[model samples]
Target chain A: MTPKISRFFAEHRPATPCLVVDLDVVESRYQALHHNLPSARIYYAIKANPAPQILRRLTELGSSFDAASIEEIRMCLAAGATPDRISYGNTVKKVSAIREAHELGIDLFVFDSMEELAKLAEHAPGARVFCRLTVENEGADWPLSRKFGTTTTHARELMLRAATMGLRPYGLSFHVGSQQTSVTAYETAIARASALYRDLQDEGLDLQMLNLGGGFPARYREDVPTIGQFCTAISQALTEHFHNDLPDILVEPGRYMVGEAGVVSSEVVLVSRRGGAPTDPRWVYLDIGRFGGLAETEGEAIRYTFRTPHDESDPDHSPCVLAGPSCDGVDIMYEKARIPLPNSLRDGDRVDILATGAYVSTYCSTGFNGFPPLAEHYI
Target chain B: MTPKISRFFAEHRPATPCLVVDLDVVESRYQALHHNLPSARIYYAIKANPAPQILRRLTELGSSFDAASIEEIRMCLAAGATPDRISYGNTVKKVSAIREAHELGIDLFVFDSMEELAKLAEHAPGARVFCRLTVENEGADWPLSRKFGTTTTHARELMLRAATMGLRPYGLSFHVGSQQTSVTAYETAIARASALYRDLQDEGLDLQMLNLGGGFPARYREDVPTIGQFCTAISQALTEHFHNDLPDILVEPGRYMVGEAGVVSSEVVLVSRRGGAPTDPRWVYLDIGRFGGLAETEGEAIRYTFRTPHDESDPDHSPCVLAGPSCDGVDIMYEKARIPLPNSLRDGDRVDILATGAYVSTYCSTGFNGFPPLAEHYI
Candidate 1:
């Protein structure tokens, strides 16, 4: 078991389905980011796990923020982050939100369409704005397809509109997608943004900043290159693509900073034999389910590694389908995960779901089907 | 616009992505159920929409509760529901949840497996127990699948064990599935349960009740047989199958009780044309999405009817893909819903999603990516 989980249970017995976060691991991850990408400013995305303790810890680390909403901005400010260090990263936003952010002295913002640009102009004039460029975004576990960014031509027009609307066109931004696995995805995205930056300069709009959006992968069940490897690839790409001059760089790391730092401890409610056939998947029900904060399972598309009380060397284990404690059938966590679950596992035996620090609690439903919200206990 | 929606916006200008529930409509739905199935008892599943105002109104309407957790039992009691009127409906539960429910005076409980029956015997001995029978649930908008219920043989063994363990073998329950469209699905399931009920009686353990679990369809985007049709089919099936005698009838209607009684009022965040070709779906971003209380959309598997400010017959509409304001690509509500969107529809225009009272708020994620939780405004 991870030391944090042991520490959590040792300090005090908690109910089933509790999130245990290791603050020491978080600090180490933050240090790794700065150590590798010395040229890039770090902005911690609060959406992954917005616990106040996490925010306070990051603020103490001198981390900036890539806030997606006004609530997140307020959270960052409350955690001691300066207004200058916060960026309104969401392209799609309300006019009132724009006004409030500007009122709070948040100048840096992002937009992708002229519709949003017009709203910004009417709501908060003369604010620093960045246009998001659409990327191919291949090899990402969670590909950010049509939901964000815009076509290159549309982005150029949006930046031009930003300048005309009296808004300072400060930079260009692009995301390679969340949990992006390939190093080449960033290289290609950087090259595209570099070209756009030079082209905007030709239009007399020389953007001085480049916000390489968050896609930094976390070490979940699978293996990902170290943060240092990702940073080195990005650094080489910047030197090769921007050749003459490098713009001030900013990176938003949400999952990568917290995913490995937390573990979810849940109890098994039932181990029922369903489907009857030996080839059929056995159903293993838990107190916490998809709505109970393990939603990233997303129809079991993201296979998280599972660990039971059995020793790692134990050869006896069972493969089973995992489900949550809700009336809705969609509350399934894993359709068929080949985890080393003990055959002797019964009701009340705790199962450790590793690397669930990010996206679990933040995406939790509020007491669906009489199941209470997933409890979070930070150390 | 729906009358409740207009009245809601008229009375109070709430924030975007809000759920407006009409208690008067809920009362009407309750009366309809009573008029249609006088022999059957109604248990409103609190998981559908557990707004306190809703629970209180239902309590005032003399609606019994099918609680899924101890928290739900507390909510029902707080709303003035007697212990005898409540049933612990969820099959999968923790030991503590069972203990607390028993402590709170709830006795009617449901189970589908020996494991859960054992837990109930240990935690809440001598309590009334109902075994859920697995059914071939077809024509359901949300199929229960393998998450609940058990094989006929397994259920029989469970009931016999319940009697052996000093628990009252009260009934046999089967869910034809939530939002089940076909009346025949219930008829088939009821016939199967009736046969098993007779078999259990042969074993000297006569089941006293048959819970035709929640499957009653609601009028969502499509048409369903009226409550009268469903009731007649069920009533006829019970008489025809049971012949000599029938147990007390119980019906748990979740979505049917409140789906049409509520409307979701959300604002259009962005209306942008992407993908280029006529075949490419236009993207319509909304402040509300799957995470924003409309999770029943189920990755566009469940389409909700929408209304805009445009006249119903302006011949000016577009088929657009709907997405939430979050940066995640999976925040899409619909891939292609042919909403009657005005050609002039822009940011800040209101769009009313109809028949959203059920499953919406219950499955909503809390403040994902800084987007606030869906606010409920009851009329």
Candidate 2:
């Protein structure tokens, strides 16, 4: 456990099923990213953890905002983010919201489809818009399907269309997917962006920026390189691809900044064996579930490393099936995680879920089966 | 399309990505339940679309409530439901919430665990509690796992223990799961409850009630028997199994009472055919997604019926992948639903998602990627 996490719990004694975010760690991560990637301007994607406290802290540290919705834009503004510092990053936005964002003086936006481009042209004329270049990325925990970006050929056509429609075809943006671990993915995505930048320039439309969209991996149950390592790979790739004289580069890093900064402390609501046998994975239910946060566990794709008060080194420790405290049977954490849970484990035992700062609260359903969303405690 | 649905849209023309709940249908469904299942007292499960207007309409029709959390219980009370008329239906609850419910004069609650029983025995001394019986319910779209219940032998021991702890072991309960199509599932679950009831009575502890927990079906993409057919099967089984002096039967119908009463009108945000072929699944993106409202589509478990303006007989139509308007890839609704769509369908085209009253708004995430939770429009 980190010192801030230990000290925060010791001082506050916050209730179980609460998310404790260590701002000190968030600052340290930000500092590391700033030091390593000096060329790239960071736009903290607010959807990762749009908590006002996190926003204010990131704002103070001079982080710009990548807002997906008007609500997030409002949140960023509340944290003192100006329109220029905030980009309407979501391409799949309501046409009405386009006008609203334009009215709010948010000029920079991302658009992929002809429909979105038309909406942008009609509503937010002369606005700076980036075309998303689709890249098939592997090794990402959540492989963002081919939903947002487009093929290079299609992207070229869209950028040309954007220029013709009186909108500034500003730049090229690409996302390799969420929790992207492989440094090679960034190198590949940057290379693709470089090729697109050169292609657009060849057509007389000078793409001003290269938006290196987020996929920065956070340390969870998986092994991922540190921010410095990721930055080193990225810096090298940028130097090689851009040939030293680089245009304005931007990154919307969501998970990397906040994922490790927050931890969720949940309570074991029930400890029961499904069947009579000791070998049967002991069914452990926590007070928190997908609706109460930890939604990344949808389909058991991403498993956050956990710390139980019980010692697994004990001989009695065994594999267990974990579930959330809800009437819904789908509220399961794991079918089987071979960890040393105390044989005498009972209700109310604390289970600390680590590295949950990204997409936890924002993904939480309003209230499902009476289970309220996870309460956040920022220290 | 239902007549009321058309009238609702014609009269109001509510914005896309909105929930339109028709009170007339809710009242009509209630009337049918009252007529068919006369012996069973109905409790509207608040977790299924906890809109205040729906609650008030149900309350005005003399319907009781089944609340999952303290917040739900408070909503019921605020909507004019008496404390005695509301049952704390969720088996998994916090000890503090149990205390809060007891303090609020919620006399009835459900418990399945010894840990919860102990908490209840201390917090709410004389509260009437029901022990849930585990059943393997077949033909249920959402099959409830054994996470909330125990076997007959275990439940008997729990009820006996409840009596010893100075709490009223008032009844036995079992759920056949949500969207249960086969009436046989109810019959089988009822038989299990009857056997448990008899065993408890023979042990010198008389059970006062039988909670035939929710599993009632809603009209979706699949074929399901009418409410009358389900009630007949349940009624026959109850009459045969109880022998004489039938206990006060309670049915917590959440989806059944409201599912068909509401419709979600979402705009087609984008239409993209991923592969360059007519056979490729046409990808249609909507303004709302899993995070917005259609969370029952988690794993595509509950496929709600959809109404598009395009003609199915058109030779140009093809199989489609329906997705929500979000940056996340998982916001997809259908990977391959062979629904005919106009190949020319573009952004802002309205698609009516039917029979979505239950588990729609309550299951929606707060807001993801700037798409706000489904706005409720009560007509």
Candidate 3:
């Protein structure tokens, strides 16, 4: 937990199953990214956490936004971000959403398929559009390959078609995937996108941007590459591929900016051995689970580290099946990971799930099994 | 689609990505379950769809409720259900929830472990408690066995312990699983529970109820056994085990009660061949996805059939990967299933996902990706 969150919890004693985000951490992360990648324009992916507080902070920091829906564009506007700084980032958008975004003055939009390109041409005529390229998400914890992007050949045809259809084929974009751990994944994607950028430029399309879509990692149970390391690799790749003729670099960072800034403070609801066998792992139920904003825990992909009041007092730990306090069986967060929690853990003991700022609160079910959405506390 | 829902859509032309529930189907389902299982008292699991309209209707039909949390209990009460008609069904709960339920005059509770029994004893003193038994979920589409319940031996000990902890050992309960297709699973669970019941009875504890917890299936992509078949199987099992000394049967039906009663009407956002290969399956993006409320589609576990305007008009069909309109890759619902949709399906075409009344609306993320929670309408 950050010092801010720790101090807030000590003084306030807020209710359990709440997320506490340290705005200081968010600002520092933004500074670190900006400092390291000086040439890149950072677009805060608001889908990660669209809290007005965070948006306002990023807006004041001069950070642009990449919105998945028009609701997000409205949120950015509410946060004082100009429509020009907001990019309609999602490739799959309704015609109405396209028209709405265009009317709202958001000029930049993304598309991968021909149908979406057509929608953009008709609904937001003459708008700047970027075609997303299908790239292998080899090193991402959560692969985003199959459902998005298009083959290079398809993207080329779509971009050429976009210009003919009176749309500005302004750039190319690709996501390595979310929670991407390897810097080489960025290197690989850059190489692929740069080659395509040259091809599109040769084909007479004035591609002004190389969109490095969000796949930034957050520290969870394991440490990840520092922002500097990722930036160094990214910078080196840009130099090797662009030969000093670099396009305007745009990096969308969702998980990285606010991920390490928050902690989910949940109380243990129950601790027991379901089978009553000595060999069985103890089941520890928390007030929060998958539906309670830990949706990233699906398939045990993003393993979050935990902090308990007994962490120091009771040093001994044992394997436990961690689950949310829901009646549904699939609500389990980490059974396969077999998280080793402190042996002294008891019902009502506060367990802090660290690095949960981004993508946690927003993914919460409205009230699954009568458990309300994860409460937010921005410190 | 139900006649009522079809009529509603035809008349209103409600916005895309909304849920329309036919109240008539919910009532007919209640009547069917009641008529088929005369011995079983229906406890409509409010966690499935806690819409006040359904709750009030069920309340008027004299249906009891199995609430997963205090909020659900409060909702049931708000719908005019008496405290006596509600049972706190989740085994994992906070002490605050226990105290609140007790204060609300809820007398019946379910538990699977010692820690929970103690909480009930301390907070809801002298409340009737039922032990949940861990049973094999052999034929369930969404197996719910591992996260809940305990072994028969453990349950026996827990019930015996409940009596000493100032609680009544009311009965035993078991969930075969959700969307369970086999009637034999209920038979097997009943046999196991009855054996434990007799053993506990010999030890001088009177168990008066047997909760055959919810697992009742809703028709999805495939047909499931009718309510009459499951009731017949359960009746035979109870007769064989109890030998005319039958206890009060309690059945909690979450999915069956309303699963088939609702339809999610969504518009096709985009449809494309991403790979640009003739052999490649088309990707169909809908306005609503897993985050929007079709959470049961996770793991492709609950395969919902769809109806499109082009279904008949186009005549020709081709395999397609159905996905939600989220930038996230995991938002893709049915790639493995390769649902065959109309070849002529185009963007903005209305597609109706059927049998989604239960468990769909409640699991929707508040606004993941800035897409608002699935709107609901009752006809």
Best by DockQ: 3
* Two-way TM-score contest, 1 vs 3, winner: 3
Return the lDDT, model 1, position A194: 90
Candidate closest to the true structure, highest TM-score: 3
Per-residue lDDT tens digits for candidate 3, residues B160-257, read 99899899999999999999999999999999999999999999998899999999999988889999999999999999999999999999999999
TM-score of 3: 0.99
Interface RMSD of each: 1.8, 2.4, 0.8
- Pull out the clashing pairs in model 2: A69-B370
**Could you tell me which 10 consecutive residues in candidate 1 chain A have the lowest summed lDDT?**
A272-281
> How would the docking of model 3 be graded?
high
Off by over 4 Å in 1: A1-5, A275-280, A312-314, B1-5, B274-281, B312-314
Backbone clashes for every candidate come to 0, 1, 0
Candidate 2 lDDT at B252 equals 90
lDDT (C-alpha) at residue B173 in model 1: 93
True contacts kept of each: 0.71, 0.50, 0.89
Error of 1 at B374 (Å): 1.9
The residue pairs that clash in candidate 3, if any, are: none
Mark the regions of model 2 whose C-alpha exceeds 4 Å error after superposition.
Answer: A274-280, A308-316, A338-340, B1-5, B274-280, B308-316
**For residues B1-379, could you state the per-residue lDDT of candidate 1 as single tens digits?**
3576687688888887899888888889999998999988999999998888989998988899999888889999999999999999988888888999999889999988777888899999989999888897789978895688888877888888889998999999999988899999989998899989999999999688999989888887788998999999998999998876878899999899888888888999877765334454567899998888788777566678877877464667766778888877888877755554666777788888888888888788877887777888888
DockQ of all candidates, in order?
0.66, 0.49, 0.88
TM-score of 2: 0.93
